[model samples]
Target chain A: MAQQTNNFSNWISQQIEADTTFTLSDAVRSPSRSRLAEGIFPTRKDEEWRYTPLGQILESSPDMDSRSAVTPEFINKLKDAMPQAHTLVFINGQYSENFSDNQTHLENAGLRISRFSQLNSTQLQMVEETILNAALTDDNIFQHITLGLAQNGLFIELAQNVDTQTTLHIIHISSAQGDTSFTNPVQVVRCGENSHLKMVEQFTSLGQAAVITVPASYIQMDKGAGLVHYKIGIENNETNHVSNTSVRVAESGTYQSHQYLLGSKLTRSNLEVSFTGPDGHAVLRGIYLGDENQHLDMRTYMDHAHPHCSSDQHFRGILNGHARGVFNGMVLVRKDAQKTDAQQTNKNLLLSRDARVDTKPQLEIFADDVKCAHGATIGELDPDALFYLQSRGIGKKDAALMLTRAFAAEISQEIELISLQDYLQDKIAASLNEIVNASI
Target chain B: MLSIKNLQVSVEDKPILKGLNLEVKAGEIHAIMGPNGSGKSTLAHVLSGREGYRVDAGTAYYKGLNLLEMAPEIRAREGMFLAFQYPIEIPGVNNTSFLKKALNEIRKHNGEEELDAIDFLSLIKKQMNLVEMKENLLRRPVNQGFSGGEKKRNEILQMAVLNPTLAILDETDSGLDIDALRIVAGGVNKLRSADNAFVVITHYQRLLDYIVPDFVHVLSDGQIIKSGTKELALELEERGYDWLVDKAETQA
Candidate 1:
């Protein structure tokens, strides 16, 4: 495992030297940059990353940014199906105007979606002089250097009382003629007071053995305003992508985020949503499926900073083969945050004896008047239930699928968006398809 | 028909059944009334192949096949049913789906075609009337948040749908009220047939009042100490299990 992770990092760094879009300044070439890179790939020393050994994943893994050389047909299909979101296309971490437009809905007033490196000094000052600076710091040593060396991503904002629906799709296609490389793209979203917005960001890699590191933050959502952010990271075994999400929910406002992690060799996502308002609420929902030796780690913190605010966190995963999964949901209710209602639940199903899951549903409450509950369970298929199904004529594989589906059905029921819910159901069907076909 | 020969069982390293034995032919309703700690429910669990209880000695044959040789589900598929004394509650798992899978598993095991959604729904509706169970209970998860009486009725409802040939009702009448007892007993009576058998394990004679037994026996100390007609239950009901315990003690 150590050798595999070493080989993967070496291959990724070499690809960086060869790729034009992955260019980095001298600041990005330090030991600190490599340390931040370590945060994405877990080490044996990390507690939350216990079950999934990042070393093992890197050993046999492909590059994280090895997306395919695009075909015209693929481009056409993407343009047709892509929602009219404030779309931003990033090809190997470089802007692609042929697939983007900044003049989106409600963005004419104090809103800009462009390359981060292209921002003026005033914009750079705004990025420096912001409340997000406290929470979005590069705590991981390597991430600090990467942030210093990185350039060019996305910058979005929602002016006070301005309602907008901008869909941003970051299509990351790997170069056809190169080794698997790495690209750290940082995107920021801000919503002013009394404003409303919905954004969907998607990341996909096309090719074999590509690795991409996404270190991004959204200083979005203001008092009396609402934001719904959806992130769908779907990459094949050819890529290992890691993303960090920091969300800020203001008083009387709402921040909702959903993550669908279905692809990647080794995927680690750190999501932190802080409810710093009276009566503010944050909802974090995610679904991650791991097959083979695929490892997906999720560490979330729903910090209630203000009184009467609430947060709901739910993450469920399915593991097959020797696949491993980790979910650490921390619901922290600070002192004086009375009347707060916080709930966190993480459930997993291990399809094989070798499949493993480590889930810690943690709740830290200092307020006595608050209500918080957390639960986590890891178990194999119920034998009596399985026997009950098989005796009725269902095949063993079908029976296993039924049990796993039943476990995840409760979470799927929570998705209010019909199309998204339908999409998830279809994905689950595809997972079971192999089971049915395997019998033949 | 079910037959047990020199059946011996133990639970948690404690011997419960020591060379105990009984037989029930098709169409026969055999009632086994035992004193406390007499291994009656243990026999039911062991017969159904429930985990934990180990069979130290004995061979149980259900229609010439080794009953203990099969898994719990295969035994269920093979027409052997054990209505648990305390039915397990599984929330988030629907009653309709659980029963459908169970029925279909038995069908599939018998090499029958699997029922589609429409057919399965209609079959569930038909069985709902047989047990007088509300269609709503069938919609909920198995035994989840159900009242005591409702749980018993649901168990009988499953039995009606699965159509088991040999049912060992292990004190299904304990938690039920009088009305619930009547409804459940009525369902069991309706399912009784010339080709099916029953072993009703109970403490009180009240359950026998609803579904009268063909034969009654007093089980004491892991073995049947006395056997007689249905009249024995009435006598024992008039005189508690202590009288039988004393008789067994004197005989020993």
Candidate 2:
């Protein structure tokens, strides 16, 4: 296992070294390159990765030369979810200008959305500073790999007090036909003082593409600002997705995030949020539905470094057909962060006997005056609940579907966007229907 | 409308219902009075096809069809409704949608066209009024966070909407105040028709005051020990069940 970890790190380092077209600045690349050169990758022995095995990700070599095309109809269907938003498409980690919307109107409205390659010197410096200032306590090798090898991503900035009504929807499509593809997209989002921004990022793949996606994102919310971010991952079953996101909220600011992981052979999402000033708030909600040997892992770290800050997290998982899910969450209240209110909850449903879930919710409160609570639950559908519905004339399968959909609706309904919420609920129901039918 | 012959049941090899028998025809309302641990709930559960209950012997026939052979849903579609004593609180399933689905499923089984949203809303609104249910309860999840009275009222509301042929009320008056009991019994009376029958199971004679039963049966040790007219309930309420239990034991 140790040798395999070393080989995976070495392979990533070699990929970085061989790419002559690495366009990121030296400041961004050198630290990640040196870190990769250290060749210390995580194994099952590591506490943070005890439940997730990276064997499938390590064995498949990423083919950088392979490129496939996405049909316009498929892109249009994705766009229909957020039709009024500013849509940006990424194919194989490279921004597709032909498919993306023109952002001149947004630029005129003091909202800046630029590709990393097109960022000016000032904006690039801001991106670099945000990455450097992120409060990520459990930074792993995948983040460094993304920083060193990232080819293209967006750099979005909202001016002070500019609460744009239009959302920014970023769609990443991996279209690799024969060989396994690799993509590392680094996103930087900065919301100025008193600004509000809503962004939805969707990751999907074409056909049964073998893709490895290691993406990193850094977000900064200024005083009194608010950011609502949503991520939906619906990649092919042969794909491996590993992503890290770090966020910092200033005084009176709010950061809300919702993630839906519905597909992928293996997925590991690491999210960290810290309150840099007093009176900040964070709300996190997510759902991971896996079926048929899929492995989905979610890790979250909430740091209450300022007083009067509150964080609430609720995540759920539904697994079937030998699927496995893991939720490892930690909420840390610093000594000086008095009167902090932090709550973390995780609930999982295992539909089949072979399906499994490992949930651990932890809270470390150094502050004497704080309200901190964490809970984890794993169980099957309540037979009483099922019979209640069945006795009402609903078929057994339909009753099961209704109950499962209700389980997901608790989280999906929290999404503020109506269209996106409907889209996700439909996807969840479709996937659950397939699982129920197959199991029956 | 319903018939049971020597219906014996056990849970985990422990007998709960030992040779229970009952017969009901259209338009008849029969009240089964029993003490606690007398297999009252077991009979209700067994009739509804709940799991964990073994039917040791006997058969339940509904309209000349084998009721025990059908799934719970099939039994329901065949116009059998069981109003639970303690309604299951199902979070996330909206009450309105659940009722709509149930009603439509039954309608489809009867070769009738399904109700659209507008028609369903109208139908449910009427039923809601019949049970005096709060309008907000329709939007909430099924029975979640509901008061005991409200849950029972919701069950009556469902019974009214479903309009089952053979409706079994399993101690629906257990958790209700007098006023709630009056309203619930009133709702059941409103829905009573010549084409339908009811089996009201309760331990108290108070509910019988509101919805008077045509016949009263004393159930003891899983079997109906005494059968009499509605005056028998008042007699038992005045004299208590010990005299009857003692008489039945002496006869046995």
Candidate 3:
């Protein structure tokens, strides 16, 4: 069994050796190289990755194949679906200048914007330092793999007291053509004191071939800064997505993350937030839909390290057609973190008898004065409710779709951007209809 | 017009309705009164096509169509409605949205254009006055956290909005107070016409006072043992059910 496990990692290493394009940047070349050589892929024995099978992802890689290109028209089609924002496009892990817009205008307004390759040597050093600091606390192997494999990524910074009224949209499109491929895209964001920024990260694939995406985001917020981050991952059926997201908040800072997972054969997302200063607040909300033998997992960790900090986590999921889901949330209050208030709730609705969910919400408090609560529930759609809607003359499928949409509406309604909220609501409705119709 | 002959129904392999027969015509209000385990609600469930009810032998005809052969929504679209004794509480679906979907689906089945938001609101606002239901209830989730009277009133509100040809009230007045019963009955009365009909099921004679049924039927062991004009309800109330059960057994 152990030898069988080693086979997949050895195959990955061999594939990495055969690919010349996969190289580390000059700033942290040696460290990233050693990290890559350390074999970041975890086996089933690892507690955090026990439920997710890594061998399936390893066996699907086409490391020796060439990267497929995307056209400008394809990017424009994607941009038209999103709300008005500064759009940044990346194809197969590399920034595409031909498809992106508004970089110069944003830079002129004191908003630092650049691709990883566009950054100067000093900027590269800063990125390396940030990666090192984040590595100290992040035990996720996917994050290190992203650090080792990512060639270019979007980097943004806001000056003190500067607010970008418009959102920053990042679209990552992966095209593997007929070959299996992998893409690692990283993003680093810094918000200065009293500044505010809203960003949307969208991941999509264009080809029929299998693709593996290891995406990571590292965000730092200074005193009184605020950041609203939303991520929508709608990959193809043959794709695997592993996302690692971390946010650090300073004194009186605020961070909110809205994650919507719609499609992927297998997806795993890890979101972590830590309060390093007093009076920091974090709101984490997510809703996911799983269909057709898919496996979706979400893990969240909230750390309250200072006094007078608060965090709330709300996650809901709908699974149908033999799909499976997992939600594990933990909120920890340190010894010195008094007056810490943390709340977490996870609810799941399964549409079929075969559909299943495993959810656990844990709260750990070491502080003397703190309030923490967590709850989780898994249930199927109420037959009485379905019959009620059907008796009102709504079709069986339509009734089910309406209930699923209502279940997802709680999370989508929290979006501050009205247009984005409407856009996501439509997507959710369409996807639910498709899932219900297909089952019939 | 509705007709049933030798209808026998079972739930979980246990028979509930055994060889029951009844007929209801347009412009008629039929009140079905019986004791607690008399399968009053079972008739309502069987008519609405609720799951888990197996018809061992029966033929129910609604406008020359086989009612039991259709799905629940089809039965609803075919102008059949059931006001549940216990209305379901859906926590996230808005009341207005739920009603509009139901209304439009029924209209579409009848080859009529669906009502837009503005038109639907206008129509619902008028019906809301009949039930004396507050407008704020439309903004909340369907029956979620609603009081018992509010839930029953909401059911009547739905019946008014749908305007089905055949409406079955299954113990709708059980949890209602006297004023609420008057309002709910008034709403049902307002919707009455020569082209539509109602089947009012109740355990007490008080609801019949407001609705004023044209015919009253006593159900026992899933069969209509005794049926008469409106005075039968008054007699059943005056003498209680023991006298009727003994009479039914003696006649059998």
Candidate 4:
């Protein structure tokens, strides 16, 4: 039983064939599916890994279990933000249509949002059409996990010229505690030509158990369209968070993402955006706070595929108590993509003797007329500054917390929602206080 | 109000200050003039308790208390100020915040209440114009991207606000132009009174034209070889330290 040769793909094929929500074809027989599984399923030799070895996670083969009941505490958090916006709530990856719905009201019949468990044949066809019509042609790893094992998720659509003023909130709460309980959540958002959508997402794990949640999201921004996306990851240390989100910006469109990961035992985030047409712009920012042997890993790719586009990226991490971090960012400029302006910077502060951070900023530029600059700094708390603060009678812990909060101030204030920003600020400050106190 | 007796120091085991002695009573300006490598800055570092300066044998007194017995900030609170020749640059720490912290620390040490933010801001704004400094520098990081003259003027502006009983300007006129030097010295001149003493350290006699010290002392090999009136500074400007070196050699 320890060395069983029964691959999950064979089981996956049988499971889907028996199920009524999906249909299999000759395409499923190909090796691409297994290869994608092997890729996202961590092996010991992966370089993007090494620190976060998944051998421990795959020991029992965590599969989504029976749907978890949403608690009143989580319900209140979701209701506080967007009481009127069409919301989608998922408890342990199963979409709850009673509390949140996508197709309640729409300007046009074609524009809608629905949970994965309630999708019709036409909705599956629409997914096939969007995947076929867009630039994504390859079978990716995260997508493989989404289709093969994920139980339930969300699907969103915005028809041409349909602008929604309400903010769409996707709230994912997990209580995966016992054996063989892993949750994979998927969200697909598509904005038609000249359409607009605002997304506010929150990922939280209830304070019960050690669970792993892998969320994969795809957003398609059409020509002359715009999207404002903010993601808050407040998973406690018992949760291992893995998310891969990609956006395709059409001609002259605007897309932006703001990410905040307060603390987790292990976190792997992959964010990518492509400028599919000219005159596109993207703003990306991320902040992570790690302590007490927690490991946070993030890799981002900003593909400047079109001419006359601009992108800005800045990420900050505060680590303490042997916590390690990795930030790998790549900005790719194609040959014909001229007059592109891109800037990237990563700054991390190590607050303990054993804390470490590895940051690599990669730029692969083929064009000659682009302005690209990237720099990273890894440093400790300045003694002079600490002493300066201590000399003012501010306790050492308060001083350290203040400096850590100041390190993340510019980006935390960038969050559009005032309450969300303050919430994150308090969370980060509390984490810093914990680190400072434990050191003493 | 201050005294230093047999103050000896070294850098990397090589002796720099050999029994340097100096005294300043209240309401007096004492100028310590010397050649390029005469331990003038080493004296300032030792007095300020900057790390890595070996105080071999020395004693410094301010208002009859053990001056070097406390941390730099505490020494500063006891009305002893050393205007750094090259101020340290601290990025992300607001200049106004830095001054406010230092001011409050000094005030708290003296058993006085710290001023509120509104009062502190108004007080700093008043000093900003006194030193001909733009208020913009106060908003940015401390001493970051400041020009040589601006850094010097900022130091004096701090001196004006702290209102120390004993102010030591350690080559405050080193890199300043004529206009900046005159304005800086004018600011110091306004703070001059019977209660506060001054120590102006310099290698050149040009600053003497504005500050006009009451006593001029020549520091050679870390000891004051001679003490004279302001006319001696004029004489040293004409004859130079080379003349003094020749006279010491012939006398030896």
Off by over 4 Å in 4: A1-40, A50-52, A60-89, A95-113, A118-143, A159-165, A176-181, A194-198, A383-403, A436-440, B11-15, B63-69, B80-82, B245-252
Report model 1's chain A TM-score.
Answer: 0.83
Cα lDDT for residue A428, candidate 4:
80
Candidate 1 regions with alpha-carbon error over 4 angstroms: A1-67, A70-134, A141-151, A155-178, A192-207, A317-321, A348-362, A366-368, A378-399, A426-440, B249-252
lDDT of 2 by residue, A1-440 (tens): 24345445657867876787755688877988887777667889989999998887777667756656688999999998898899999988888889999998998887999877788888888988998898467767889888887766678999999989989999999988887888888899999999999999999998786899999999999999999999999999999999999999999999999999999999999999999999999999999999999999999999999999999999999999999999999999999999999999999999999999999898898999999888999999999999998888999999999999999999999998999999999999999999998886
Could you say which candidate leads in DockQ?
A: 2
Model 4: which docking level applies?
incorrect
Model 2 docking category: high
lDDT value, residue A109 of candidate 1:
55
What's the TM-score of every candidate structure?
Answer: 0.82, 0.98, 0.93, 0.84
How do all the candidates rank in terms of TM-score, highest first? 2, 3, 4, 1
Expressed as tens digits, the lDDT of each residue in A1-440 for candidate 3 is: 13343543565556556655532355554566565577666667876667777767766545527555687777876776564888888888777778788577777676888777678877766666655555524376677667765656767888899887868889998887876778888888889899999999999988767888889888889899999999998899888899998888999999999998988888999998999899999999998899878889998999999999999999999999889998988898999999999999999998888998888788888999998889999987788999989988999988888888989997898898887888789889988888889875
Ranking by DockQ: 2, 3, 1, 4
Instruction: Return the lDDT, model 3, position A75.
Output: 80
lDDT per residue as tens, model 4, A324-354: 8889889999998899999999999998888
TM-score of chain B of each: 0.97, 0.99, 0.98, 0.96
Enumerate residue pairs that collide in model 2.
none
What lDDT does model 2 reach? 0.92
lDDT of 1 by residue, A295-391 (tens): 8888787888789998888888888877788898888888979999998888887777777888888888898899888898887777766644544
Please state the error at residue A261 of candidate 2 in Å.
Answer: 0.3
